[model samples]
Target chain A: MNALGNAFSLLAGGERETWWTIATSLRFSLWSTVFAVIPGVPLGAALFLGRFKGKRVAVAMVNAIMAVPTVVVGLFVYSFISRSGPLGSLNMLYAPAGVIAGQALLAFPLVTAMSYTGLQKLDPRYNETLLTLGARPWRRMIAIIREGRFVIVQAVLAGFGRVTGEVGVSMMLGGNIRWYTRTMTTTIALDAGKGEFERALSLGIVLLGVALSINFLSHLAVRDAR
Target chain B: MHADAVRNDAVRNDAVRNDAVRNAPAFSVSRLTFRYERKVAVSCDSLEIHRGETVAFTGSNGSGKTTMLKLLNGLLGPYDGRIDFLGLPLARNPLLRDRSVFVHQHPVLFSGTVKDNFEYALRLKRVRGAEAAKRIAMTVERFSIGPLLEREAGRLSGGETQRVAVARAVAAGADVILLDEPTSSMDSASGSAIRAFLLELRRSGTTLVFSTHDASLVLDLAGRSVRFESGRVVDEPSTGGTL
Candidate 1:
């Protein structure tokens, strides 16, 4: 009971760094989604719609990446961007950009795989109809993408949810610096580790709320697409 | 109006002359073959379609009628033979893409209103504003699609959707319209209405090539019947007369 009270009191104290952590996490997640979505949707559409020799291999790689662990992604990116690594000259370590890179990598495959599945499941006759209409290749692609916009939206939102709730990548890459790189996930881990349970619990609640809202919106988008 | 009438008569005379010339041997298909890997879809030795004609390609499932239609529209390239469209070898012509259009067995509707679907093809042809509006209205009214213009294509019934599909094809001004079992999903009323619509299209100087299993419907519409058995045209009539 005393531990619970202490945690509650800590939350009530309203640490300025906690708010900054939440803001940074959100900003990082937003950028990750933006970067990932721009290429992901087109990549997915091409994989599903295009006829090319290496298309099967590309699809297989994306499907494999869908299960990649966030911490592994962070570690892999960290090796290149760290002070003594190949890209060390860029000095990207312990920064939001590093976190964004990790999160973007993590989100990209999810968006792409889901979008590919969505487009693949569409009626084959749709493509035939477009061809019969004398629509050029690019115009046909644009029309199909427009028709499947709702499914694409859901895939992007799902990617956003995955990135925003992840802790391992942010902790490994962002270094959990106060007001600079600290994010909701990292702050929650840090506060919990330090026995500041109330602040951790508050941030946890906010994270769950974000996840629920994303899932709800995704559900709505899927329904709308139908 | 008189000039337009004279132009129309000239087109009709050309169609009649082409039809007569077709009787001497109109459609020339030589060593036509297609295959997807090891699976051979179509292997026609020879075939011909007359001008101003409605030809029906009938076959059981997987007999390659649909594939033949695709080949006619240049959607699929021939593995062997040459297909000649309007005295031009199909393989060597850029005008084939502009001249031919295909309609699938199932209508594919965009996520917009029916009017938008009509306008999409017109807009592609660079028709806009009053010119576009005038043609669209004429097409919609001709096909009795005015009530359906404001409705989303997704909400249309099967018959209504097919009607709109045919309307869109006509509005696109395709010289050779290929329909694959277009009336297969419609009720009798809708099917008859569609048949009537095709007759009107023929009168308006459009050449139609379609496939159907419904013998009665085929008898009513097709001037030439091409029967298929296992990926080849088994029997064909050379009457070249309107049904």
Candidate 2:
């Protein structure tokens, strides 16, 4: 009970920092979702709607990537951006950009795979109906995408939630530098590891709040989809 | 039969026969074949649908009625032979896309409000603002879908959804409306409404080709019937079921 009281007091006292942390996490998530969705949606749409040889292989690979370990993604990206690595000259390491990159990679396959599932579940007759209406290919694509908007929205929310609360990528790639590269997850990790239990618990509570909000939104989107 | 009824029937039959010959066929399929993998869905068939005429294609399940409709709109390319729509060969010229439209058996409704679903086809064609609104209103009134315009499409009943689907297709300015079981899932009231709409469409010179399993419905609407069996058209009217 004392611990919970201390945690709440710490959160109340550190409201500014808490809000900053939340704002930064949101910024990162928004950019990551934008980066992920741009290519992810079209790729998923093509893989599910287009008919060509080896399409199955592409879909299989994306589905496999959905389960990719976040730590593994961090490690893999770390190798390429580290001081001695190929992209080392960019010096993106230990920055929010690097964290975004890692999160984008982690989120992309998830968004794509879920979007693909949504598109595949659509009735093929929709495509045919559009084509018959003299809709151009681009037009047909838009119509189908618009029809599947609810599913796409849910996929994006899920992807955002996955990245916002993820620790492995931010911890490894951002180096957890306070007020520089530190996100909520990384802050919580650093505070907990250093025995700043109140701060850590505060961050943890905030992260939980974020997760719950995202889950609520996703649930609403799915209900709207039906 | 009553004298007035006999006269009306004779005049209707004559008008149908004359129209069949006078109006150039909106769709002409010659020696067409379509296959999925190694199995044939439709084989070496010839058909022509005249402009402003309502033609019905009837057959048992898997008789290729749906496949034939798909061919008219370039939804499926033919494996052999040719399909000409509005004097353009669908294979050689892609412009048939500009003038033809198709409606599916199971209507596709988007996840937005009813107005959004109705406007989707027009928006694709780049119609917007007041012009788009006018056409939408016209269609909504025509289909009596005014109450449904603000409702989410996903929440509509099957019959209401089908009405919106048909309205959207028609509003897209389809020179040819191909309905695949448009009324298959509707209640009697909705079915009657749709039938009335199709009749009005016919009078307005829109060419309609539809497939149905309902014999009586076909008899009431179609001027001619084309029957298929085992992937081929059985030519004799004796074998071909009457509309």
Candidate 1 clash figure, as a count: 2
Q: What digit string (tens of lDDT, one per residue) describes model 2 on residues B61-148?
A: 8898888888777778537887766554565343455556777787777668888876777887678889999999888877677888
Say which docking band candidate 2 falls in: acceptable
Please provide, for model 2 over A27-115, each residue's C-alpha lDDT reduced to its tens digit, 9 standing for 90 to 100.
88889888999988877776766778898888889988889899999999999999899999989789989989999999999999988
* Model 2: residue B22 alpha-carbon error in angstroms: 11
Q: Estimate, for each residue in B1-243, the C-alpha lDDT of model 1 and write its tens digit.
A: 122332458676555445543453324577888987778888988888766777888989888999988888777864788776765556644445566778888778888899999889777666788998898999987877788999998999888888888888778777678898978978998888888888888787678888899988677777778888889876576545546
Candidate 2: the clashing residue pairs are B219-B243
Taken in order, the candidates have interface RMSDs of: 1.5, 1.8
Error of 1 at B46 (Å): 1.1
Relative to the unseen true structure, what is the C-alpha lDDT of residue B183 in candidate 2, on a scale of 0 to 100?
81
Error of 2 at B217 (Å): 2.3
Highest TM-score: which candidate? 1
Q: Using alpha carbons, what is the TM-score of model 1?
A: 0.85
